[model samples]
Target: MLFNSYTFLVLFLPLTLVVFQLLRRGNQRMAMGWLVAMSLLYYGWWNPDPSKPWTPFYLILICTSCMINFWIGRFLAAHTFTPKGRLILGLGLTANLGVLFYYKYIGLFERTMEALTLGKFSIPDVVLPLGLSFFTFQKIAFLVDAYRGKTSKYNFLDFLLFVTFFPQLIAGPIVHHNEIMPQIQRTVSPSRRSVDLSVGISLFAMGLFKKVVIADNLAMVANPLFGAVAAAGGRDLTMLEAWAAAISYSLQLYFDFSGYSDMAIGAARMFGIKLPVNFHSPYKATSIVDFWRRWHITLSRFLRDYVYFSLGGNRKGPILRYSNLLITMLLGGLWHGAGWTYILWGGMHGLFLCVNHAWFALRKKLSIPALPKPLAIFLTFVVVVAAWVPFRAGAFELAANGSAQEALRATKSILASMFGLNGFEGWPNAAASEVKFSWAMRAMSCVLIVWLMPNSQQVMRRYFPSIGLRGLLAKTSMPGPRRFWQWRPTWQWTVFTVILVMGSIYEFDKVSEFIYFQF
Candidate 1:
C-alpha cells in the first residue's frame, strides 16, 4: 500500500499504531510479531491480476528468502571463514543473487543475447518482486557481516522484523541489522511514544505535501514531455522544453524519493525506531561524490562497503580504484533496472565520479583552490540533472516497452536540446501564456526549494538517535538552539503541520505511486 493513500492514512496507520501501543504494554514479542504479520499483509496487499501473475508469489518469495538467509547467516556466524565457511558464504551469495538474477535480469539477458546472435527467441518481461533489490542487499549485508562475525545473537523473529519492517521495506533507506534490531527489541516501552508520534506526524505531513503536492504536480510537466519524445519514433522538443522536462523530472524524483524517505522515517519513528537518514538535501551537494554521499545514502554505503571495499577499494592505486568505481556504479545502475539506459546512466556517473576523484588528485598535487561552494553546487546539479535524462528515459521505458536504441535516442535528443545543440528559436513553442507561466513557476519553484530549503531530517533535527553518515552529523542538525522552523512538541508547530497535511489532503484524490517504487 502506498504511504500516500487514504487507506494507509485513514485506516492502516492508526490501527497499527493503536495495536502496537496496546501490545507494547504487554508482551514485546507479540508486538513485534504483530508488525511482522501486518508488514507481510502490507506487501501482499497489492492485488494480483491476469496481467501481472507474478504478484501472487511476492509473499511466498520474501518469506522463503528470509528463511533461507536467516539460516545462512546463522551458519556463517557459527563457523570460521576458512575451508567450509568460505564455500558456504559463496553459495549463500550465489543463492541470493541467483534469485535476484532470475527475476530482475534474466529477461534482459535473454533479449540481449538473442539480438546479438540474430536469434528470434521471444523473452517475456519479468515483473520483479517488490522490495527485492532493497531486501536482497540488506540480506546480503547481513550474511557478509555474519561471515565477518559482526552479527551475533539475532533470533529469527528479530531478523524477520528487520527485513520486512513495512515503512522502509518496499523502497528503503536499506536499514542494516545493526541499525534497526536493537530498536525492535525495545519497542515494548512506550516511554517516548508521544514525542515519536508528533515527530512522525510532522515528518509524514511534510513528506505527504512533497509527494502529492510537489512531485506529482511536477510529474504532470515532466511525463508528457518525455512521453512525446518516447513515442514510436520521437518528437523534436525545443531547448526550453527539453531542459525544463529533464529538470522537472529530476526534481520530481528528488521529492518523490526523499519525500518517501521522510515518510518512511516518520512512520518508523511512530514505532519509536530511528531509521538512518537516507536523503539529506542531496541536490545541495557540491560534487558528484558529495551527491552520492547525500542521495540514497544507504545504497551508497552498501555499495561502498560490500562492492567497492570487496574489490580492494581505495587501498588500491588510482587506476584500479577508478576502474572499480566505474564497475560498482555500472552494477549500481543495473540494480535499478534491466535496461541499457540504466547502464548508460551508471556509466555516466562512474565516469563523473572518476573525473571528480581525478580532479581532487590533481588539486592535491598542484595545490589548486576549490571552486566556491555555490558554484560547485550549481555545476554539480547540472551534471546530475543531465544524467537524469537517461534515468527518466529508462523509467519511462519500463512501461513504454521501448527498445534500448529508442531509449538511447530519446535520451540523446533530450540531452542535445538541453545543451543548445537543438533549436531554441521557438522557445516555449506555441504554449499558451498561462500554460507556460504555470509550468515555469512549478518547475522553478521546486528548483528554489531544492537549493534553499532545509530537508525533513533538518526540520526534525531536534530529535536524538538520528543517524547520518560520516561528516553529515552537522548537516542533519544544527549545533545551537532549535531553529524557529525546527520541529518541536509545540502548539504552533502542530498548526503548521496541520496546514501541510491539509495541502496534501487536497491532492489526495489524485494519489499516485512514488517514482522509486519501480526500482
Candidate 2:
C-alpha cells in the first residue's frame, strides 16, 4: 500500500500503532511478532488481481529466500576463514545473484538473443518481486559480514523483521544488520514514545507535502513532453520544450525519491527506530564525487563496501581502481533496470567520477587553486542534470516498451534541443502554451528551495528558528539566530502542517505510487 493512501493513513497505520503500543506493555515478543505480520501484510497488499492470488506466491518466495539466507549466514559464521567457508560464501552469493538475474535480467537476455538470431527464441514472462534488488543486496551484505566475523548472532525472527521491515523494505536506505537489530530489540520500551510520535508525525507531514504537492505537480509538466517524444518515435524536440522537460524531470525525481526517503525515516521514527539518512541536499554538491556522497548515500555505501572493495578497491593500483569504479557503476546502473540506457547512464557517471578523481590528483600535484564554490556547484549541477536525461529516458522505455535504439534517439533529440542544436522554437500546443510560464515559475521555485533552504534534518535539529517578531525577542544578536524559516511547534507550525496534510489528503484520492517503487 502507498504511504500516501487513505487506506494506509486512515486504517492500517493507526491500527498497527495502537495494537503495537498495547502489546508492547504486555509481551514484547508478541509486539515484535505483530509488527512482522502486519509488515508482511503491507508488503503483499498490492496484488493487482485478487482472483489470481499472486501475492501469496510472492510472500512464500520472500519467506523461503529469508530462510535460505539465514541458514547460509549461520553456515558462513560457523566456518569462518576456511577454504570451505569461502566456497560456501561463493555458492551463497551465486544462489542469491542467480535468483536476481533470472527474475530481473532474463527478459532482457531473451530480447537480445531474439535480436541477434532474428527472432529464433522466445521466453516466458518472469514477474519480478517487489524490492528484490534492495533485499537481495541487504542479505548479501549480511552474509558477507557474517563470513568476515563482523555480524553478531541473529535469530530467524529478528532476521525476518530486518529484511521485511515495511518502511525501508521496498526502496531503502539499505539498513545493515548491525545498525537495525539493536533498535528492533529496544522497541518495547515506552520511554521515548511521545517524542518519537511528535517528531515522526511532523517529518511525515513534510514528506507528504513534498510528494503530493511538489513532485506530482512537477510530473504533470514532465510526463507529457517525454510521452510525446516517445510517441513520435524519438523525433526532435524544440528548444523550449526540451529544456522544460529536462528541468521539470530533474526537480520531479529529486522531490519524489527524497520525499519517499523522508517518509520512510519518519515512519520508522514513529516506532522509535532510526534509519540512516539517505539524502542530504545533493544538488548543492560541488562535484560529482560530492554529489554521490550526498545522493542515495546508502547505495553508494553498499557499492563501495561490497562491490568496489571486493574488486580490490583502491588497494590495487590507479588503473585497477578506476576500472573497479567503472565496473561497480555499470552493475549499479544495471541494478536499476535491464536496459542499455541505464548502462549508458551508469557509464556516464562512472566517467564523471573518474574525471573528478583525476582532477583532484592533478590539483594536488600542481597546487592549483580550486574553482569558486558557485562555479563548482553550477558545473556539477549541470552535469548531473544532463545525466538525468538518459536515466529518465531509460525509465520511459521501461514504461512505454520502447527499444534501446528508440531511447537513444529520443535522448539525442532532447539533448540537441537542450543545446539549441535543434530549432529554437517552442512546441506549439494548447497544453504547452497554457502552462509554459507557470511551469517555469514552478521550476524556479523548486530550484530556489533546493539551493537556499535548510533540509528536513536541519529543521528537525533546531525546531525554533528566530524569524518575524520572534527574532526581536531573542537575547543573542547572532546572525544565524536572526534567520527565517525556523520550524517551531507553535500554532503557526500547526496551521502550516494542517494545510499540508489536508492538501495531501485531497490529492490522495488518486494514490500515486512512489517513483522508487519500481527500483
Candidate 3:
C-alpha cells in the first residue's frame, strides 16, 4: 500500500505502530512476528482480490526466497573463507540472480528478440512481484557478506524481518546485513518511543507534503507535457516545451522517489528501527561522481561494493576502471526498469562519470585549478537533466507501446526539442498572477527549494537513523546538515507538523503510487 494513501494514513500505520509498541512491552519476539505479519499484509495489500493468480504465488515466492536465502546465509557463515564457502556463495548468487532475471529482464529480452526478427517471435509478459528488486538485493548482500565472514549470528526471524520490514521493503534505502539486523533486536522504551515518534511524524509529514502537495502537482504538469511530445512524434515541440517537460519530470522524480525514501525512513523510525539515508541534496552536487554519492545513496553503495569491486574496480588501470564504471551503470540503469531508455540513461551517467574522473586526473597532472563550485554544480545539473530525457521517456512509454525503440524515439524527440533542433520557442505568455500556481510557478518553487532550502535530512539530522552516512559526512569537506531548522518536541513544532500534515492530507483524493515502486 502507498504510504500516502488513506488506508495507510488512517488505518495501517497508526494501528501497526500502536500494536507493535504495545507488544514490545511484554514479548519482543511476538512484536517482531507481528511486524513481520503486518509487513506481509502490507506487501500483499496490492493484490487483495483472491482470484488474481499471482497474488499467492508472489507471497510464496518471496517467503520461499527468504527461507532459502536465510539458510544459505547461515551455511555460508558456517563455512566462511573456505573453498566450500565460495562455492556456496556462488551458487546462492546464481540462484538469486537467475530468479531476478526471470521476473525482471525476460520481458526486455523478448522485446529485443521481437525487434530483431520483426515480430517473428513473441513471449508472454512477466508481472514482477512487489519488493522483488529491493529484497533480492538485500538477500544477495547477505549471502556475499556471509562468505566474507562479515555476518554475525543471525536467527531466521531476524533474517526474515530484515528482508520483509515493510518500510524499506517496497523501494529502498537498499540496506545491508550489518546496518539493520542488530537494531531489530532492540526493545523500544517509552522515552525512546516519544522522541522517535516525534521525529518520525515530522519526517512522514514532510515527505507526505513533498509527495502530495509538490510532486503530484508537478506530475500533472510533466505527464501531459511528455505525453503530448510522444503523441506528436517528437517533431513539433519547442525548446521551452522540451525543457519544461524534462525539468518538470526530473524534479517530479526527485520529490516522488526521495519523498518515498523519507516516508520509509520515517515510518521505520516510529518503531525505533532506523533506515539509512537514501538521498542527500543531490542537485547540489558539483560533479557526476558527487551526484551519484548523494542520489539513491544506498544503491550507489551497493553497486560500488558488490558490482564495481567484483569487476576489479580501479585496480586494473584506467581503461578497466572506465569499463567497469560503464558496465556498472548499464546494469544500474537496467535495474531501474526493463527498458532501453533506462539503460541509455545509465550509460550517459557512466560516460559522464568517466569524463569527470578523467578531468580530475588531468587537473592533477597539469596543476589546473578546479572549476568554481557554483559553475561545476550548474554544469553537472545540466548534464544530469539531459541524461534524464531518456529515463523520463520510459515513463511515457507506458502510454506509448512499452517498446525500447519507442522509448528511444521519445527520448530523441524530447532531447531534440531541448537542444533547439525543434526551434526555440520562448516561455509561455501569461501574466504573473495568471501563471500563479501553474507548472511554471511550481517548477520555480521546486527549483528554489532544491537549490536553496535545507532538505528533510537536514531538518531531522538531530535524530540520526539506525545506520547511515554519519561517518562519511564527517569525512567530507561539505558542511553538515546542521545549517537548517532542527526538529524538536515542542507544542509550536507540533502545531507546525499538524498544519503540514493536514495540508498534505487535503490532497489525499489524488493519491498516486511512488515512482520507484515499479522497480
Of the pair 1 and 2, which is ahead by lDDT? 1
Ranking by TM-score: 1, 3, 2
The C-alpha stretches of model 2 lying farther than 4 A from their native spots are 48-54, 187-191, 426-435, 462-491
lDDT of 2 by residue, 1-519 (tens): 888888888999899888988888888778889889999999888685657856588888888999999999999999888899899999999999999999988877887787788876657777788899999999999999989988888889989999999888999978899888887886444656876766777888888888988899888888777766777544566787788888888888899988888888888877767788788789999999999988888899899999999899988788998999999999989988888888889999999999999999999999999999999998998898888888889865565366887777778888888888987886557654524666755774687788888777656655321112123224444335524565655687778878889988888655678887887
Question: lDDT order of candidates, best first?
Answer: 1, 3, 2
Give me the runs in candidate 3 sitting further than 4 Å from their true place: 48-54, 232-235, 398-400, 428-438, 475-484
Q: Would you give me the overall lDDT of model 3?
A: 0.84
* Model 2 local distance difference test score: 0.82
Candidate 3 at residue 111, lDDT?
Answer: 72
Give the Cα lDDT of each candidate. 0.86, 0.82, 0.84
Q: How close is candidate 3 to the true structure, as a TM-score?
A: 0.94
lDDT of 3 at 88: 87
Query: What lDDT tens digits, residue by residue, belong to model 1 across residues 296-336?
Result: 99999999999999999988799999999999999999998
Off by over 4 Å in 1: 48-56, 123-125, 187-189, 431-437, 469-471, 475-478
User: Weakest 10 consecutive residues, lDDT, candidate 2?
Assistant: 464-473
- How many clashes in each candidate? 0, 0, 0
